[model samples]
Target: MVLSAKTKQSGVTSTTNMDKPNNSKRPLSHATDSTRTSESCDVLVLSNKMMTNLTSEFLTEQTTQPDVISKVLLERNKLKDLPFELVDFINLEVINLSYNCFHQFPSVICEMLSLREIIMVGCEIEALPSNFDQLSGLETIILDLNHLRKIGDTLCTLNKLTTLSLGMNYFSVFYSTLPDQITKLNLDNNHLAVFPDCILALANLRQLNLSFNRIKELPVEIDGLTELEELLIVKNRLHALPSTICNLV
Candidate 1:
């Protein structure tokens, strides 16, 4: 359930199985050229190593060449800062750095012009970069279980984004204007007290989750979601059903 990727580099798009048995405990710097076999493909799988300890020579030796690696899986490695050499992978399309120690959204990610998806769940991220909208090719972003207290307005500028998950964060209000193409939105387990009026703008939304919040009433505007097929608002403090909800059918 971590991040995965498909790369046009190496003319190969493969998924790295994090479940693979780690038979090599050798330091990444000592990994022989033989380890870069077809079995590893384009994935540089590290087993529970602290990324901060990796030397630039070790990284360069592992990748051999920047264009040879199109996908990088650094999840669960307790990464605090992105490797400075990662920008060399000019064709990178996906990045999954979940379950790490990141406290702020890495600004270095914006430099990957080819990135299509970013998964960073269970981090301490408090805010995204101001120019995050420059990632025009990004299509999916998952930032669940972070420390975010509010959605950024720049999020609406990613015209290609279709899925966004912000569940289990510290959000008290929903004020950002999401792109119209977003089909799935997760805002579960936040501190919201009232329904966000911005939800009405997602005309193409098909699924929405607002569970485990402090909302007290359903807005009559809920009927504006004509394309919605699944709505989850359980665990709120609703006293009565809004009659306008009948218009959903």
Candidate 2:
């Protein structure tokens, strides 16, 4: 599945129809009262009888033809663990589990081989699974507003990854090395104190965001990012920009 637009940071709306699921009866889950105020809940209220029938049909179809079930949106469900039945969707390519109460990255997602994009914003995720590299087809990952302190080295093994967003986290250092295929990277609103030299290795990087951090200075080696087009360094502690930045002109 081709993603036509980037995931927005404000709300759970998408610009493309691909983000919408095929079944109209299945609505996106909402935040539970324990996770959010009742006034904030946007759950679709269905009669108990209707819900039971829908659930029965869903299980039957999923059990018989799991490959037909692709694209899942469980946003704002306050879920700590995915339902075991979700594993039946073997052909899933896109999944959005954003705005939940997860304390760790759900291991069930790691088992999906066809996943191309995953959005898990505003959660308590601390770390990715060690075997996250198993998702070779993954291209975009948005983990903004989580509790991640550092990423595993397995992330760099996703050679097809092009867009990665890790903003609004608690990272104090850039520990994980990025893949050279990355085109857009967002590290804004973190606790980084140093410019990671590993970023210079992304020869295909076109957009980079380092805003709202504690970085003191950038290295002259940044000039090596010849493909960079838009660089955002706002709200940082940088004293001066390197003269080599003018080379981009």
Best by TM-score: 1
Instruction: Look at candidate 2 and give me any clashing residue pairs.
Output: none
lDDT of candidate 1 over 40-123, digit per residue (tens):
566666535666554567778877776666556666667777756677888877677777887978777988888887877788
Estimate, for each residue in 130-221, the C-alpha lDDT of model 2 and write its tens digit: 98999999988888889988885878889999988888889999877888999978888899999877898999987777767888777888
lDDT of each: 0.71, 0.68
Off by over 4 Å in 1: 1-40
Clashes of 2: 0
Clashing pairs in 1: none
TM-score of 1: 0.80
